[model samples]
Target: RALAQRQARDERADAARLYGRIATAHTYAGRYGEAQRGWRAAAAGHRKNGDVAAAARALSELARVQEYAGRPEESLRTCQEAVEWAKRADDIRLQAALQLRLADTLEHLDDPEAARLHRAAAERILEEEPGDRDPEPEHGANACEIRSAPAEG
Candidate 1:
């Protein structure tokens, strides 16, 4: 945290990345409040630094934290905002991944029809852009795998 603050005083972009890492650590530690705050700061800092992709990713993580905190409605809103940011970033893979996440959130909210629509949208995105693969894994797995997993019977 101190290092992130120090970096914030010098390099806003780097500090935003540090803040993201801190937030991820907090998430793994089960500290949802700290994670939420850190992710919000990271997203804002990244946006202020003109790193829309990073900001979108931060928002995505924030949405996940909200979901983990059992606030699916808030998660849905945050996920929607993240999808918009991903669109502005022109990152097809991130957009698709976020759509899948939205689908999952929707399912949790008892909106199966909306979830199916989002899942189909994500599939279309992946099909339309065969060459676009995310360089980094999202949520500890391949986005495609997340999208394509078969339902448990």
Candidate 2:
């Protein structure tokens, strides 16, 4: 939560990590609106720091929280933005994961054909990686750890 205070003071990098922590906690607690807001803040912080990949990840989280909040159309747009950010980062594995996420959002949006195409694209990208597939981000600490930390009063 110290990070949040720092964020409030206009410290972007610390704000980004703290927001991620807060969002993860909110998600666990089923507070989707708060989670979405936290993640959106994190995305802004990441973008300010010139970390497009991190911004993409935050947007992906935001999309999921939006879905949980029963806002499928909003989630779909956020997922699409995440895909664009992943593409800009040139991380094929990340791009593929984002494409799969986009497919899920498209399915929720009632666009089966678009969802299928996105799924196929992700599959093709994975196939190009040989044995490498399903790469996840390497955050040092787990979500529970982040949640356990005391929030600043």
TM-score top scorer: 1
Model 1 over residues 69-114: C-alpha lDDT tens digits? 8788998999899899989998777888889989988988889999
lDDT for each of the candidates? 0.83, 0.78
How far residue 89's Cα lies from its native spot in candidate 1, in Å, is 0.4
Please report the candidate that would top lDDT against the real structure: 1
Q: What CA root-mean-square deviation does each model show from the true structure? A: 4.3, 7.5
TM-score of 2: 0.79
Candidate 1 residue pairs that clash: none
Where is model 1 poorest over a 10-residue stretch in terms of lDDT?
A: 143-152
lDDT of 2: 0.78
Clashing residue pairs for model 2: none
Candidate 2 per-residue lDDT over residues 32-80, each given as its tens digit: 8889889999999899899998898888888888887878898888888
Off by over 4 Å in 2: 8-11, 129-153
